[model samples]
Target: MWFSKFFILLSVWVMLSIEVESSTHWIVTESGLIQPRLNSPFDMERPYDLLAFLNQEKRWDAIFENYNDLMKHQKVIDALWFDVGEHTNSGTQILQDKDCEKAGNINAIDWHASILDDGSEKVPQEKYLFPSAYHGPSTDVPDCKRISSLTFSMFAFEHLESMMQRDNLSANPEYVLPELLTPIMTLDQFGHWVTGVLRENSSSWLHYHMASMFWRIRGNAPKALECSRRAVHYAPRAYKDIALGSLGVVLHRAGKSNDAIIVLSAAIDHDPTSFVNYFAIANAYSVIGEYNTSLKYYDDSLKLNPGMELLMRHKYGVMCQAKLSLRIKAIRETLNKLRDELNVYTQKQEAWTKLQTEFLKTIKNGEETIEKKAFERMSADNCA
Candidate 1:
């Protein structure tokens, strides 16, 4: 009896220890951009990269079939980091999802969410979209420009990316344009923060530092160069970090690799770890073919949070031993191109069948949500 009692006490102690050891934390860059503070989720970070953060709970549920799998089995999972908002600090789209799945560490990051690989879903509906907005041009902008990037988690980011691309050409697009969406979440966060900083303090140095991010998001058309040049003159060491980093991104995007390096080096001197600073540095290095240095900074980034798969794929995606490419090789490939099957139902046939079934009771009772009843009736008759 005493042995069993002692064992019970020890088990309780161990459980407490596990919670204490793995408790989540919050992360805020120097600029005050907040994120969940999980350990290195990205395996590496590098230049000319992308980090796609999606809120796809359903696919995560499928990939991480058990709860333990969230923290322990990222090696088999890819796309959104499960502990992103739950245990770590960042949510919302961290970056675009292009080519993210092709990289190798998707499973690695997701699996590392837990030690035991408990891949079960205890949370509510996995496909629910988080209520949020994509960082837009400025706070002064109208709400429509502020993207409510609400997407069902049942569809992965990559799937959504494909949808966005396809729909962009459609007569009635269901979502925001990819061009606008990329900047706000991908690099727009930095630009918007800079604008806020400028409002708080109009130091010339700050303006100069913010120029590159402005141009990059704005697209590196020739007109953006003057904004960056003025930023250099207005540079104060305090604000130079922000200015140079932005300038570097703009220059790299404009295909001026050499200028990007010179500009970014000066910025890093002010302070590293500004919002996405190292990632931009890696981007500059990649443009100049300095993959090793890019890889070094990327490694530095991973030390802070290793699940930055977008950066990893971007910097090393072209390398012979790229993690993502290798993972693609290892996994069985499939055709992702979806078939759009449209079922046409005349009103007579549609209303006659579905309304008589799911909708009849729903309509009579008036208790069902309008959407629920409509979809049920529509589904029953294959009517829109």
Candidate 2:
């Protein structure tokens, strides 16, 4: 009975081992490096330390603040595009449904909330509330930047606007003036604002910078490329490196490998120590089968930012392709060397065995000859 039970347990363990070995897929890390994931069905299910997530929230908050400041300055650049009216009491909803429950209060911010509340849950209850319904269009620019802040809060909602659009409560919210209650900010509103901002400030490379981001989020590659190019065109000589590098990346994404290489090369010339520019140049060269140049740039990038897994993966990929191109020659050279070594060893072994065998045979014959001569002498003595 004991033996049978042990066998069954061993069989189950073997089955589980096979299942684990087979259930893995490629996943990209937060740092944009590809890695193997074991049965990760959901984004939240991926392996991550809770402590790190908590620690990162502060950094995320700081980023949110910076985005808000940038938007404010952006509005200042094109104040005409924004509605300028009196301050009005706007009904704004900070949380809805499950988000409100997660915050412990239907209308207050809870710092220790376990639920993953996006920017909505963090909204100030005194300034905002869940609007009963979408308010009608308002030309009034009433007081309180909180409403405007909410529109920009979309940036803090999530890392990618795509993910926010999918998960947020406002899937299809109506647009109203900043003074009135807005359940959510639509991408259409975002695009319109960015377009107007760019149009109003033609010389402001900063507008181009923002337009590039908006276009990228919308998956409009051509518009993104144009915005990046305009950004580069209007950038000051001192800031050309960043704008040029951004343009190179956009070009590479748009499948203009040769153009990307040219732009990235210029960026490298402007800022040779920038590892990101070098890596981008390497990627562009790789697309055109310039493995040697790609490898060199990859190495240069690694020198500038050693121990980055993303750079290492890029370098490793190029190294593999370069090695594959020479695989036939390498294999042939190795086989030839091995064959020569084996042949020399075999010949030496055969010659030593043959010499040893001959020596043994000659010794046996000498012994037989001595025995015969002794036998004959003994016979003569007997006859005498």
Candidate 3:
């Protein structure tokens, strides 16, 4: 019983003896930009905390809150957030059936085949025309400066990029001008154009969904959440997953990982085939330290989008963290065993020391008795 108690105490002591190292996991460069660092080898797989980096910048809040401030600091914002030399239009294609209806008869067969490949509903061709204002400055002379549908779509995307500094542009081309006209428009003009488009297309869920992405990337969580909710309200039953996924991402960015997980789960239920939703949910789980669960979702996403290098990297990082955690656990157990052994050795040493002291005292008492007896014998002889 004593030995068991001693082992228990030794285990507790070993646990308490472990110390947590205090260290910073990021650094500020000469340009005043914060960058993440691997504080230890175990942290190599950790994800970059973008929200934390943005929070370190004093101007981010002001720029996100005020449109004028954001436009004034657009160059700085782009340098900080925008991908270098990457085209803004290279985003996920919106493959809704309604989008197929807009293409003319010449492209109808191709659109149908694409939709069919995705197992979505077949779309019927429909005639649609945009208001004259949506056209370029050459709207007055339509034949003189006629633009192809593809060029017009690219122009609208550029205008959206000018305002949002990201590719969160609405795929709908009914609310923007031609490429020839976008180059001459100022930042204020682009803002006004976006406002006008939103006002005119208040019922269009895709616009609100794109707007939510814009706000999300701009670090305006409240506005992003509001826009996401509006998008959910206006979105069709078939396309609700897009809005829900956006909401989940917004919540994750706002430091609400648990809430993000709940919303992302719902998004997955709505559209299980969307790899992006799975990836977002995986990230949410990762933030909350549910690495095993995160890995499962990451694998699910990889199955859907096999070519996603980014997802692969994230998964690899999480795996490394999981391995590190196991290693730490094994180390703690080893320390506990070593502590128990040391405690036993110390007790045996104390017992041996006590035995040696008792033996030495007995020898000293025997010597004292002999000396007393000798003195007594000498006294008797003197008396004779």
Query: What C-alpha lDDT values do all the predictions have?
Result: 0.39, 0.48, 0.48
Residue 222, model 2: Cα distance from true site in angstroms: 2.3
lDDT of 2 by residue, 22-53 (tens): 22323546976443333221112222433332
In model 3, state the lDDT of residue 208.
59
TM-score for predicted model 3 compared with the true structure? 0.42
Q: Pick the candidate with the highest TM-score.
A: 3
Candidate 2 structure, TM-score to reference = 0.37
For every model in order, what is the number of clashing pairs?
62, 9, 0
RMSD of each: 35.2, 36.9, 30.4
Q: Put down candidate 1 lDDT per residue, 221-299, tens digits, no spaces.
A: 3323444444544555544565455545545555555655665666666766542556666656655656577777666
Task: Determine which window of 10 residues in candidate 1 has minimal summed lDDT.
Answer: 111-120
- The TM-score values for the models, in the order shown, are 0.32, 0.37, 0.42
Model 1 scores a C-alpha lDDT of: 0.39
Positional deviation of residue 141's Cα in model 3 after best superposition, in angstroms? 32
* lDDT digits (tens) for residues 1-384 of candidate 3: 875555445434433443332123334469763333332211222223333322322222232234333333454434423332122222222122232223212221211000001112211112111133433332111110111111223212222222233224222111223232234443234334444556655665555565554444345655555566666666677777777787666666555667667777887888898888888888778777788998999899999989675676677666655554554555565555556655654565565455434323332243343245335534654687
